[model samples]
Target: KLVVAVQGTRKQHVDTVGPKVDRQKKSPVCSYNEWDPLDEVIVGRPDNACVPSLTPEVKAISSPQQWEFFRKFGGQFFPQEHLKKAVSQIEEMCNVLRHEGVTVRRPDIVDWSKAYETPDFKSKGMYAAMPRDILIVIGEEIIEAPMAWRSRFFEYRAYRSLMKEYFQAGAKWTTAPKPLMSDELYDQNYPVESVEHRYKLSSEGRYVTTEFEPCFDAADFMRCGKDIFAQQSQVTNLFGIEWMARHLGPDYKIHLLQFKDPNAMHIDGTFNVVGPGLVIVNPARPCLQSEMFKKAGWKLVEAPKPMVPDDHPLWMTSKWLSMNVLMLDEQRVMVCKHETPTIKMFESLGIKAIPVDIRFANSIGGGFHCWTTDVRRRGVLESYF
Candidate 1:
């Protein structure tokens, strides 16, 4: 048996909806530090074109064709100039971090032409999202999670190769079958099922099985780590939580938020989390159940609705990419351009926000969090002496 130390809430984050076979009303017990009310965003440095704040610590493989793919599929909305601005912003972030003491690591962009050479990388699409679990760095090694999609063969060999290069040891993947009926719920556009798939990946890969047909939807994405744990209790759900508790211990905390809902297209399409204690969520998408937000101690800043008419070309174009932001550190954030409200909010709070143009990357449905896995992150300080 794997002897991993895990902490945080045992309850699934989805439980706020209602109690069912998979979800329960169990009082969450957290050994980790409670989220503090985040009020101010402290800008550490000046906004210098030369000085760096947001940095590209890591990046996925890229190709010219990949860039075209983004333009055709995800970047359809923005003019060339807008797109350029986004790309430049990401570079600025990377420079800023390097300007500071932090080290920025970029993955050699993936070469899709010779993909088969890497046995572990199955062609999910031109943009293969970085697994969330594996990206989080723990000590010297990076933890990885991989999943399977219909007709897509599991690329165990490619995984092995990738892990060996970037990480100290090989990776451990998390995945499950496509549990939802349709990829979308109620004809909504954003990627709700994709978020649900994350839970499945974590549970099945960890050997948890509820045997209950899992459900998926857009709102499910925003469910925090605690909410997801609270809803899970069946063989698979419980097993998943227990494994994480044992393995992760008390250092890491999981949080999830949604940018769209039943009629929505993308959560990050217009919203994102740019830093700790701040989120750039679009009010048009619909508000999440307040309990989840309150418990996590996140402060929300509503973004303006999409400027493009609901049916315009730019309408909901960000769906192809995951629009939400990822926290590389306390000071820097990576965000999608459409999530401008979030970017501005972070800036107001003094947190530096770097907007990455993900039109090319979003076609397969991933944002900064889904695209890059943080192999190592600073551990939260232990509360007790």
Candidate 2:
């Protein structure tokens, strides 16, 4: 008879316990790539989202026209009225997900206005509004990225509860080595005054982030089964991509892709892989390796111009958020309700577009794809490239 302790009390003896079942069968996290049949996901919250200070890293990615907004609102909560509408919009998005036969989970809401300091740097927090920037699910493991921004260093706290629950349920959880985010990690004198100058620098493989330490945003990577695509951008460096490549090991292949954009940060807004061999390429920032995808028999579709009015405030990101769509499955996608061109483009591809309005949420710096991270999708690992 086998005995087991119960809460430090007397033990009970019973018949022999059976051998452990297959972990994969009991795993609550099992996504290998994008566009798999949907199962469960984690949607982010905007309750107490705060604007980040206008640091060097922030300035490198943001446009000059929007600098004034960050200068005025840094270290403060986003406009309350706008945030309220954003909250409502995101809630409706969650409802839409639930109705579509997919399970939706949310991160804990914390006061992002709190400030903290590490030996290397001191900064206040930013919102938990974009889970895709911090959490990535590859196979059975969920990776917490060592974010590049000082303001986002503690963002993982918002997702710890869910991560713990998933770990207890037999899922693997891995947090990459946290970066120090000290002054050495950034290029203090990155020229941002001239768009043409920035473009020349980016074309020459230069960016605002230096190689002091490995740093990357999870959004800089796009997963596709056995092959993963990565870009060295303002928030992601070559060192970080090398880290991910070595970490994944021989089972997967990582490709380094480049674009023509001057202020590249996240790849999803520029090169989004929607299906097994279909990709939506940004018209404004053409991919340099287009021939590679074309030769592989993959269909590369160019997204239409975004229709966001110039008067609307897009303080942190470009209008290309219209292309930053979330795929519920290969057959369905979540898109902005106002972006009729994007919706039409999806329709033309035989994919159904589930439109939801999150315009206010986009103002904070993310689209549907950025606001959520897929935890479980019904699929197996296969070579898509």
Candidate 3:
């Protein structure tokens, strides 16, 4: 029961908050690891996708050269032609997933161009192009991350319809404590002067986000059955890691992995766990805790160099997204049609590669794995590490 005050006799006491969870039905949300046979997914939309303003948080992860794009087009839609190509590419990618016998669901198309003001801050919005950054599934639960970016604060609005349906179907839905993204949440002087300075700061575990409160993007974590690997990135802090560790309880082991990445935003592009005891690591962002994986008899393969050409506008992320392929099962993968070396690498490992072109989609941000958040994967919770 909820308590409400009757207002002026015009509005009666209304309880509009409670959502019922049927305990009898099995949850639609279920996934323990990345390699399980995918059953359902949530693909984000590029519609009304707006450029985030060049705030301090945005400044931390992006290169100085790319700052012009954000400055000129921030809080505005991306170039019309670019967004059109991206839409078509993603539609084809979704069809490919359906052909592979997986159910693909999409978030509601939101007008991210709308500007909003919070008590602590005022900002426009970013696109709902990357679902992997906001949603993560562990077993039967879906965790909504308390992300750091002020523009992305209301990003979860796009997924509420699906979240509600999943909840009614008995999935455990959890939204982390949203942080007050005031000036206190950022280190205004956090170094981004040059690549060398970034490298030094990252090595020392210094990031732009302060420990003022818990904040993280779901993409900062990589799920591998009982072992979940996470990184403290520019958008993810130590406080956020601690919050996840405590919230996940004893069923999961959150291993804080370190990498030598200057602009480490998401772990999937850097250290992706493809299968049981098999991980594809980015040679550019070497994992400092890789010796542990080696000691555990895990085969860590180096990803081939990305083939995304120079002058290709990658507004939000790095070219390492070529390595961010999604696993359909232990035997099949969704990869870039153009990345021949990546396809060859998978074929050599006996994993069949299903090629799809999303180069234009990659321009906005994200590849296969980054584009979709797996809702259900046929698997049970078991220890792997």
Name the candidate that leads on lDDT: 3
Give candidates' CA RMSD values in order: 14.8, 3.3, 3.4
Candidate 1 runs further than 4 Å off = 1-126, 129-141, 146-148, 151-162, 165-260, 263-276, 282-288, 295-297, 306-323, 336-340, 355-364, 381-385
| Residue 191 of model 1, lDDT score | 22
Please name the candidate that would achieve the greatest TM-score relative to the true structure.
3
Q: Compose the digit string of candidate 2's lDDT tens values, residues 1-385.
A: 8876533368767575432335556689889888998899999998999999999999999988778888998989999999999999999999999999999999999998999999988899998999999998999899999889999999999999999888767788899889999999999999999999999999988899999888889999999999999999998988888888898899999999999999999999999999999999998999999999999999999999999999887778999999999999999999999999999999999999999999999999999999999999999999989
Pick by lDDT: 2 or 3, better one: 3
Q: Report the lDDT tens digits of candidate 3 across residue range 134-167.
A: 9999989999999999999999999999998898
Candidates in descending TM-score order = 3, 2, 1
Query: Which lDDT values do the candidates have, in the order given?
Result: 0.35, 0.92, 0.92
Error of 3 at 354 (Å): 0.5
Clashes by residue pair, model 3: none
lDDT at position 295, candidate 1 = 75
Give candidate 1's TM-score. 0.46
